[model samples]
Target: MRRMLTVCAAVAVAGTVVAAPAMAVAGGEAAGSGAAPWMVTVAFKGDEPLVQRESCGGALIAPDRVATAAHCLDHVDPTHLEVHVGGGTLSEDPGKVVPIKGWSVEPGFRLIPSPVDPQDFEKSSAADDVAVIKLARSVFGVPTLPVARTAPAPGSTVDLFGHGLTQAPDPKNPAAALGDQLKHAQLKVLDDGACAAGLASPGLLDGKSVLCTQGAATVCPGDSGGPLVQNGRLVGIVSFGGETAGKQCGEPTVDGFADAAVARSFLTQPRPPLAPMAAADPVITGTKAAGDTLTCEAPKWTIKPEKTEYAWYYNKVDPANGFEFYLPVEGATTPTLKVTDELAGHKLNCGITASTAGGTILQYSDVF
Candidate 1:
């Protein structure tokens, strides 16, 4: 049976229009265990070093890629975007800062009016609110999360993470705003029909590409683009949240997530070849001395490979002629190769080709 759906841009208010900021997790606790290594804090570059502002949250799905909300970078310049990984708070030096090189937003993405009014909900669509950012250099040593191929079953429990506000906004006190510390909460996925019914605008839930959650925990401004993980995989990106009768953040209301499966292909695209010792470059580990055993280590990839092939090449030494010649090393097909005395004076290099669901990538190690 086909389902009827409605659309919304941000939190809906009766008469006032409030522009939604990057959201956060309300009714949640501080993230102390550092459970989410892929969680990143997105901020604007300031004039001084280590100075950043206008923060948002994102997920590191690849060594050089971050998944976020399209609205977060809609009007911002790419050069001004700075990403901080492996941190629970903005003040912590969990990881180094990397500048954004480029980004791609879903073609179907459209901005919802700021301070969205109740009537605006009838005109906006949140189905394609996702985007991916390409970093100037790869992020190494930290773990990257994977996007779910399928949606989690309704009623399943999911974990939401963000560096947003702990309390609802208070108009009387401007200081009562969003949080800077990363927080998380557990939320239960809601059925499409029930999610739609809970909203003031009944047609706001797009069943296929968007889903909602229930319970005391909900996402608020500053949490946009954060990950909704289920069964240890990212299943959604925080898109928007519904308001309660009193126009507060919490239960009887639902928060929306852009279905990860709908944008998995774009999020996991293979990156360009990296420089030596960079994130995705193959490593040749072992001593260069004769008779020593050498092994080729495959570069870490966003997507695991189905198969891998290795080839060893020798740059033969020519005493009389200055010209260099590269000759294939016989019987060195696997990842490991033996260093022979006959090739002691020759330069040695290894080529590794990895085949993944996304595509193929070839990388070479430095000569030993």
Candidate 2:
């Protein structure tokens, strides 16, 4: 239940930031470059291709998209953000480094208290800490990891990857022990409900959006945003972890992960590069009667559209506001729509969306 802020090597007290007392990856061993080729470091812009300023860890979901914890993006200047790829250790020679083009934090993300006071640890929990980072260009060579559509079942074993301290750093010089090489460990998924209940913080590990896990191997500072892989697919992002009874690093503890399954839509939703402009509005043709089929003609676009999507909507008068508003017809997406009895007295309209490398644009047809 320790609300361990795994990303920063410091904790925030009241309104001030202070150095952390400990940060280490106990029971973790060195990870080979092949062990996690898709792994990357969310680091600051530096002179070297692979900088040692590891802020957090992340995995490439697509050539140009990385999945990480939203907290890693907090308060950090976007200009200083960049991704380091193809290196097993931070000091390794030449690797591809890409600047961050953009990023999206999943909605409803909450920041958990760092180094939560033992008395308040059980009550300190956060939600939706996942984020997707857009790289300036696609990374080549390294295979991207696919995101799991669901969380692994309890008792399932998973792999964790990160570049964090392997042992507790000397309090006098914490950064001296910061690990230079990537490390990994095996962990077991725990019953989220039972885990949360033990910590007296059910909302922290709800089993829906947050997953509960534990093992002899524990994540430490610089591990936040790292991937939790189950069956070669990413299932969670390192969110938070803490030892039992306020013990220091390396002790047994339960960790909470931002479930990738719950954030699949946010992670996989298309981000079109540009929008296609319609030369003309869409046109609907057909008899306006029940049982009659209607067709929507798409307008020409400035550029060839890669894809055209269609949708149908019906208008109904609101009794309270006396205003007519459009509601989408369930499961309607084809260019042709059926005028079913369900919409006998309603005014109907169809719309077409044109998607291209330039962008995505939508145009509505005349009411029918």
Candidate 3:
């Protein structure tokens, strides 16, 4: 579930050396600092001080939907991972843990090879370094941010946050203790035109999804699933850094996918124009069906059902006024919806919207 690219492979692109300037950064405090309220600290299995620690820069994509890198939760239980939203401290209670019901990692991204010799085909790189987390309960009371489905163009200014950046260096084994810094840095977007140079020159970039510029402050290992906010919208997820295998942050290397092409409508479900989407399956040839007696159904293809809201529209416009929903209702379910007043050829539109408990999401689907 994490971005996997051996240090050696990153130097070669289609077997060609990357021809860019080496990225360097002195490890201390790199980019973001202070208590990032929106920074989510994720832990697994309730281990001592928490088994493993990873900082996922989440923006409360939905009250129940958190977008992070798949690798952040690799080998960790989705249901058991404790999510501390809007805070810097870790959650103490096990019940506060949000169980992840479902998620889809970049289909081809994998670290453990499918076979042996396993080169680029099955590897996890920047190509698909992004993923999302679906929580059992909605993250209410917090304000979720917005996502930019597309990457920011090169030279775009961005901001990032995380729960890691500093650790007491391991003196006995210098390499062991010299981990990543949790904050600080200035970044700009690089062009995808030079992928060979991009990959060859070092820094945390892959040939697949993004192109980042690591400067004074760069993202480190624990910061893997964090968000890269730009122009007030989340444009990318921090996936890698350029520090040498044995070394820590130094030089000016940028993280990968500065301008990630995120899906604008990635969090939405499908809406339908008519209800009873295959009510009697067979349709019974021709009978004056009574709409009132039929059962109503949920929307079809609810992509991020956990982050959606539902409403039935009689025609192409508004059903009523008063309440406009952003969060989802508890009642509806599945591919079928019954018509309140069945008509031979009347058009009924259903509005299915995907949203975060904080009120952010992929997009709203309209059916009629």
Against the unseen true structure, what C-alpha lDDT does each candidate score?
0.65, 0.69, 0.43
How many clashes (backbone N, Cα, C below 3 Å) per candidate? 18, 5, 53
CA shift at 313, candidate 2, in angstroms?
A: 52
lDDT of 3 by residue, 1-368 (tens): 24211111122122111211212223223333333434455554444553134445454666777666655644332333566665433323212345544443444333432122234332224445555566657766666667776677677666666544332223453333222233433466677655335443333234455556544455544566776677657777666554322223332344564234543344332211110111111111122244532223333432333454444333333358654333222243432344433332444333434432222222223323
Over the stretch 1-368, how does candidate 2's per-residue lDDT look in tens digits?
31223322222122112223333344445676588889878777676434346778889999989888877764333445678775576776325688766566676676544343535644355678777787879998889999999889999898888775544456665555565667777788888666776453444455557887777676665677889999999999987765323434444567778999998888887883323445567888888789999889876654456888889999999899999999999999999888888786888999876654433445787788
Query: In model 2, what is the error at residue 219, expressed in angstroms?
Result: 0.9
Q: Which stretches of candidate 1 lie over 4 Å from their true place?
A: 1-27, 47-52, 111-125, 171-176, 243-246, 250-252, 271-368
Which ranges in model 3 have alpha carbons more than 4 Å from their true place? 1-35, 50-52, 55-57, 74-76, 89-97, 108-124, 167-184, 194-198, 201-208, 243-247, 258-260, 267-368
Which is the leading candidate under lDDT?
A: 2
| Deviation (Å) of 116 in candidate 1 | 10
lDDT of 1 by residue, 248-284 (tens): 4332357778888888876776753221222456788
Best by TM-score: 2
Task: Please provide the root mean square deviation of candidate 2 (C-alpha atoms, Å).
Answer: 14.9
TM-score-better candidate, 1 vs 3: 1
Candidate 2 runs further than 4 Å off: 1-26, 46-52, 112-123, 198-203, 243-247, 272-368
